[model samples]
Target chain A: MKLKRTIRQVFAIAKTDFLGIVRNKTAIFFTLLFPLFFLIIIGFTFGTQGTGETSRIQVGTVNLDGNMIDVNGTVSQNSTIGDVFVQVLKDANFTVYEYDVYGDKDTNGTAAYDISRGEIKIAVVLPANFTETLSYQYTDSLGIPIPTRAHLDLYTDPSDPTGSIIGQQSLLGFISGFIKYYQEIAINQLPENLQDYAEVLADPITVSTSEADVSGRQLRWIDYMVPGTLGLVLLWSGLNHASVAIATERTKGTFQRMVIAPVSSITVLAGKFISSLAIVYISAVIMLASGLLLFQVNLYWNVPAIILAIFLGALSAIGIGLIISSIAKNEEAANSIAVLISVPLQFFIGAFFPLDIMPEPAQIFGEALPFTKLVYAMQDIMTKNLPFEAVMPEIIYLTISGLILFVVGIIAYRLSLKRL
Target chain B: MNLNDIEIDAVTKRFEDTVAVDNVSMKVAKGELFGLLGPNGAGKSTLTKMLCGMVNPTSGTIKVGGYNIRDNAMKVKELLGVVPQDIVLYDYMNARENLAFFGKLYGLSGGKLRDRIEELLKFTQLDEKAVKRHISTYSGGMKRRVNIAAALLHEPQVMLLDEPNAGLDPGNRLALWEIIQTLHKEGKTIVLTTHMMDEAEELSDQVAIMDKGKIIALGSPRQLIKKVKMENTITVVPNKITPKLMEAVKKISGVKRSYRAYDEEEKIETIKIITERAEDILPEVVSGISSVGSKILSVQLSRGTLEDVFILLTGRSLREEEQL
Candidate 1:
């Protein structure tokens, strides 16, 4: 009879608190509205990676080389190494703006002006010795002197770091392609006897690469960010709402009345936890539905595991909120403290960036936080489609931390009642 | 054996360095309306909190309905309804919803819970407006009534109200007193704390006056008055001050204390005489002033009130302790 009464009282309090929160229109609106903003903002910003106008990069080039004289002693327009270099960059889909070798000052000045004005990202300058060095690679047979290496100067705007990086990559690709073309042509111009040595120099080390996905379908950035935004919605909605609700009750003396009532302390805490858990689930559903309809994010993978992850995540978040409520003196302090804990973890926990790419100590700190594991567990369930056994470590750790915080929170709540 | 009697033994509660309740001991009988009278910081609320098991005494024990508040706190809570000094009801919930929520906590449910909520709404006279309005929209008197109904939902034998009438106007105080009287007639033990002296005199079968965390005086109102040798005073404002009139008024029967003072601010000369019965002695006081060829401008007679008893015991009025 006693146990049955406790359950009834717990549910009674839970029902009242749940109705209080859901009926609060401001709470209902912000819970869905704020995360939808994250979905549209973070999703579209990082989501569309290789589509439309965003993927194009502009490059500028200036060749000072006059012309190339073939071993037949003819000026071959196609045989000039500078001409082959520009053709290779053009083949890779770079819009190359070519400048004259010995023209008036206006020719090279305009290219430099475009680079500085951020009109172009990369500037390639080939000197007069561009083909003269290549013509000497065939001269060892004649005992004539040959230049050892050719220098290709690359320039980019110092202030435009992102453009500078892309332009530098295009310049490097052009250099790599010109080396192969010069080697093949030089060996072909030589007799058949030295061609094997030229082939060995041109293709010194053979490297191969391969990439495959587990589902055979490429996951978009929206797939990864949706789960993170869901975790974020859970953290903010559960922690802030629960802490403020408990603190408001304390200030209003309603919490004292409940503490002094015939119900047990666990009943009061359980009621708060259950209500926050329901609100979190509602918040998660809204975020997920918005992802599906608005961004075409997939939700067909591991539905049960997603639900479980959300439940455990809400459990841990609300447990922390209970601790905040127990220690805080008022609603404002509780809100400030909850936000202080949740905002920093959002960045460090691989929600916005990968944790492995960060420094080692920062990675360790991110791993130590319970939110990091929750985000990982969410990714495993929602994005990776991992099974229960695969994600058990995170679930177990979250459950243990949640239980500890919940036990401590109940004790603290009871102690606060005595003071009140 | 009175089932609803509450026994508190040597209870002391300390919050860090400050002692809130200091070794207080009291026993209230069953079916008695006991009033705890004290100034604001006199430990009355803390002592009642200990009895309700909301606060733990630093030293000593309390028992209600034959159950120890320390070990059987839940059982004790089941036997008492507590109306805290603060309005502890949920303002976001309507009167009916608030009462229903608290009622379910005490193990009432289904049709029984619904019926009890309706009965309490009507009993507290809140049925008419509670249907569509939240408690936040209710007036102070209406909220107090609902607060009482929420406590009485379980119908415990003992009801503890910590100054239920503290903030109410005169009409609301009278209306709430009528409810207390109705509950007392139903044989429920009721204990309340208040600074209002007349409330103790009008509503209490027994009263305990507390000061500085200790009970300075405890007894029925009449018994306390008789023990303190209570006196009433009669004051007369004469046109001029004279020694003969002061000497004559001091000789009145049962006149114990007298003094004469000239007010410079009001430019009035006044004579006051304290006696056992001011009603009997007032005629002589006025006649004595008239015989001196001094016309009495105004004459006033005051009875022995609880404030008089408090001043005689503590040497301070209730207002002084509250200010301190």
Candidate 2:
């Protein structure tokens, strides 16, 4: 009979809170509209970038070298050493920009300005004597041939250190490829017996690549982002809405009325918990629907796992929201605090960007937050179609954290009631 | 005390260094309409909160319906209904929905809960046209009526009303008083707190007058009035102020004390004559003052009221304390 009464009380509070939310036009509008908004905005803005599959870095090139060289008695017009580098950039999935030739001026400054304005990421400038200097050969006094080198001036925007590093590496790879091709061409012009011997001297060693992935299918940014977006929706519905709901009850004195009733504090907490979970569950469905319709994301046979992930994510977020509501004096304060906590968690948990691309400390911090675990668990189940064993760690971590926060929320709420 | 419906034994609640309810004790018999009369900050609301199980006293015990508040709090709460000073109903929900929700919290459900809600709506007279409208759309009095109906849904034996008619106009107050009296006629033990002396006198079977966290007087309204030694006064606002008129009023039979003061705000000189029987001597006093060539602007014959008892015990007027 006692347990039945508690359940009845919890249901009563939950029904009231849920009715309050669904009946408000503004709340209903946000619930139905926000997930679609997030999906379209984040999906289109960052999802379809390079070759319509992955996000692409941008690199720019400026050929100041009127340095045309003749190959096999044919004049190579408008094709300098810079043209080869641009081709190499395009091959490496970078959208390359070719700048027009100008007189002696600070071309590096132009490249930096464009990068600062977010136009191009990195730029390179070639000197006029680039090919001429490269064609000449020098030797030591011992008669061993010394290979001549030409300077390829590479410039990058200091503001985008990551983009700059990518551009610099691509330039180095292009230079290595050019040297290998030049050696093979030179060797082929020799006699058959000498060609074999010269070829061994020209290229001594080579490297091979072995590629691996979580699934056989190539992972797109949308696949990673869809899970993180689900996490964000969880935060929106559970943290933001739940905190405001509790604080509204507090301000209206309804919370005190409940506290003074026959119900226990645990029943009150359970009511808030169930209310937020129901809201976030609906929001999760909306997000998944948006993902399928807007981004054509494949859920496959992972609907159950996805639902579990969403439930765990909502649990943790709602627990944290209750903690905030207990501490805040009013609805406005609760809203401000919820935003302050959730927005920062989004950044730290790689909700908008990839965690691997960030600095090591940031990755460590992101790994510590529950959102990262939720996103990874979702990705493992939904995108990779992994078995239960593969995703159990993330599920366990989320459950434990959620439980701890729930206890803390109850304690805080009781303390606040006592103070009142 | 054990047989009483509500018993408060030396209950004191303190916040930090300040005592909100200081060693106060009282007993309310079953079916009694008990009134707690005091100015604001006299711990009347705090004492009500303790009875409702919302607040825990620093010391002493409170028993409601034979259940100790400290141990069997839920049992105590189950037997009591609290109508808070503030309108605690959800503004977004209609009257029926609010009543149903509160009723469910008290473990009422199914057709029983529905019937109870309907009964309460009819009882509060909100069944006419306001049952379907949200509380935010209702007038303050309507909201107060719904708030009361919500507390009555589970049919608790004890009711605690904290300043129930506080913010209502005179018309609404009368309407609310009627509802409260009807509830009293149903034999529910009601403990009410208010600063209004007339409300306490008309409604309460017993009154506890609190001041500075202590009960200064405890009795029925008539008994409390009889406790004061001072007699009733006859106040006269003369059109013209003069010492001759004041002397003439003071010379009347049975007039023990008389004083004249000029009120600067109203620009009127008032003469008050305290007599053993002010009502019987009214004609003689009025004729004497008029014969002295003073025109009477207003004449008020005052009797000993709860307000008088409060003043006699505390040496301060109730309205003066309310204004402060």
**DockQ comparisons of all candidates to the true complex:** 0.54, 0.66
CAPRI-style class, candidate 1: medium
In order, the B-chain TM-scores come to 0.84, 0.86
Question: Largest DockQ belongs to which candidate?
Answer: 2
Best by lDDT: 2
Clashes of each: 0, 0
Q: Which ten residues in a row have the lowest lDDT in candidate 1 chain A?
A: A48-57
Model 2: residues with Cα > 4 Å off, grouped in runs: A25-40, A49-59, A65-98, A101-116, A130-150, A162-204, A241-245, A299-301, A308-315, A354-364, B1-3, B124-130, B230-297
Compared with the true structure, all predictions reach lDDT values of: 0.78, 0.78
Q: What DockQ was computed for model 1? A: 0.54
Task: Residues A2-43, candidate 1: write the lDDT tens digits.
Answer: 888888888888888877776677766655466677678877
- Model 1 misplacement above 4 A: A29-36, A50-53, A56-207, B127-130, B233-299
After the best TM-score superposition of candidate 1, give how far the Cα of residue A349 lies from its true spot, in angstroms.
1.5
